[model samples]
Structure formats: structure tokens, C-alpha cells
Target: MSKLEDLKTAVINGKRKDVKTIVPELLESGADPVEMLEQALIPAMSVVGERFKKNEIFVPEMLVSARAMKEAMKIIEPILIEAGVKPEFKALIGTVEGDLHDIGKNLVATMWKGAGFDVVDLGVNVSPAAFVQAIEEHSPHLVGLSALLTTTMPAMRDTVEKIRGAGHDKVKVLIGGAPVTLEFAREIGADGYASDAASAVDAAREILAS
Candidate 1:
């Protein structure tokens, strides 16, 4: 395989050191940053997510690979910004109130970033009021709420309600986590539900298309 393909393999294998090394070599060899991102990093993460969903890879593997992808991205992000490669969409993401769990949230955030959305991560234990405030501040096209515990799930509903109540009805709300289900997402009136990161990209695209 070629070096670009090797970069993809490095990310897939979760070789952070190799990913860091390869990115600069690729750049020095006159590879386009946008092409590197689109061709390698995004697709690598998407495959990782698919593996995770299929139980072919577990969370530890996913985390390392996602971390590797992030390593490459840190180098490319600046070049993209400097060259005016502004993300076509913005997504605000957070773990809802009373839920300190963030592994799932962080994974989703990283995958969203990999998918080329400018993600504003509000972090764990985010209150409904805080979600509303973030919506007011960022005006993102998509808002994602993650809750790992059954008890904390209502915070997702309340946040969604408040955002709609606040007259930000157009923005789509995407929900996910270990305990979250498709029926629950629909009952809570969310715009979409994704079981994993790769599907999250698909859901975000579908939501945007609608």
C-alpha cells in the first residue's frame, strides 16, 4: 500500500506515534491537508466505529484509534483553518446533567470532529439551562446530548424541551449512549438517535438533509 494508505492503516491500528510521524511526511511530500483528512482520518474513524458496533473491536481499541486520529488532526486542523477550510456544519455536544460519564460522550465528540463538523464540546454534567445557553451562544445546526445512566436521561429530554421552548426549533437534537434506545429517543422527541459514532455521522447528514 502507499504512504497515504499506510496513514490509514496506522489510524486503524491505533498507532499514535506512527500517525504523528506520517502526517508531517505526507505534508512534506506535498499531500493536500484536506485530502489527508477526507481520505484517511475520517474514513479510518468511520471504519473503527463500524468495528466497534459489530463487536469486532472494543472501547479500548476504539479509544486508541480515535486518539491516533486526533493526533493527526491536531496537525491538519491549523492548516485547514489557515487555508479557509471552514467546516460546513457546527455541532454542540455535551453529557447531560447529573451524569458524570464521559467516555461515550468523548468518543462521539471525537468521531464528530473526524466527520468534519466543528464540535463545541460542553462536557459532562451539563445542565438543561446550560444547554440552552450554549444554543444561544453557538447557534449550531446540531446539538447532541449524551447520557449513560437511566436517571440522567430526563436531562436530555428537558434540554431538548427547553431548546424548543426557547424558540430554537430548527436545530436538530441527536441523542445517544449505552442505555439510550431508539424508542426512548423517539419518546423524548429527539431529531435522531445513533448507536455509535459512524452512524452518528450518517444521522447528522440525514438531519442536515431534511
Candidate 2:
């Protein structure tokens, strides 16, 4: 198989050593950073997300794959930046207020980055006001909210309401988490919901395209 395909497999399998070594080599071999990102990295992460959703891989495996992706990104990002390659869309992502869980949020953020979107990760336990502030500052095309707790689901609703109330209805809102569902997301007025990181990228792309 080709080196790019090998690198893609390494990323999907969470091979950190291979990712660290092969990514730079690919860059040295004149691989386009944007192509590597779109054709390899994003698709690899999409497979990882599918595995996670199917319970074929657990959190630890997903975390390892994400780390590998990040390592590869460290090599490609600067090249993309130097080449004046900018994202097609910008995203603001965070775990909703009162929820400290961030693993899922971080995965989605990294996948979005791999898909060539500018992602601003707001970290864990982000409040409505903070989301609003980020929206004003980043002017993102989409805002992603994550909540892993049943109790904190309400925070997601409140955050969406606050964003809409702030007159930023043009900005699309997305919600996801282990406990979050499409029904719940609809009830909370979210524009979309994804069960995993791969689908999250698809959702983001669709939202921006519309």
C-alpha cells in the first residue's frame, strides 16, 4: 500500500509511533497537507468514530486514536498555515455548563479540525454567557455543545436559548454526548445532533453547506 494509505491506517488503528514518523515523512515527500487531512486523517477518524459508536472500541481506544491524529496534525498544520490554507467553516465547541466531561467534546473538536474546519474548543463546563462571548469573538459557522450528564442537559437548552436571545440565530447549534439523543436535541432547539465524532463532522459540513 502507499505511504499515505499506510499513514491513514496507522491513524485509524491509533499507532502513535507510526503517525509521528510517517506524517512528517509524508510532508517531506511533498504530500499536500490539505489532501492528507481530507483524504486520510478525516476518514481515519471517521472509522474510529464508527468503531466507538458500535462499541467495537472503547474510550481508551478512541483517546489513543485521537492522540495519534493530533500528533500527525502537529506536522501538517504548520504547512497548511504556510500555504495559506484556511478552513471552509469555523466551529465553537464546548461541554455545556455544569458538565466537566470533555472526552467526547475533544474528540469531536479534533475530528472537525481534521476535516479542515477551524475549531475553537471552549473546554469543559462552559456557561451560556461564555458560549455567547465565544460566538461574538469567533464568528463561527457552528456552535457545538456536549453534555454527558442527564442533569446538565438543561444547561444545553439554556445555552441555546441564550444564544438565540442574543440575536445570533444565524449561527447553527449542534448538541452531542453519551446521554444526548436526537429527540432531546430537538427538544432543546438544537439544529443537529450526532452520536459520534464522524457523524459530527458530517453534520457540521451539512450545516455549513445549508
> Could you estimate the TM-score for every candidate?
0.88, 0.84
Model 1, position 135, has a per-residue lDDT of 91
lDDT of 1 by residue, 1-210 (tens): 888899999999999999989999999999999888888988888888788777898878988998898899899989999999978799999999999998878878877876778999999999999999999999899999999899998888898889889999999999999899989889988988988765788888888888
Residue by residue across 1-210, what tens digits does model 2's lDDT show?
A: 988899889988889999989988888898888888888888888788778767898767877888888898888788888989977788999999999998879878877876667899999999999999999999999999999999999999999999999999899999999889999988988899988775788887776777
Clash list (residue pairs), candidate 2 = none
The residue pairs in collision within model 1 are none
In model 2, the number of clashes is 0
Give me the runs in candidate 2 sitting further than 4 Å from their true place: 149-151, 178-181, 195-199
Candidate 1 overall Cα lDDT vs. reference? 0.89
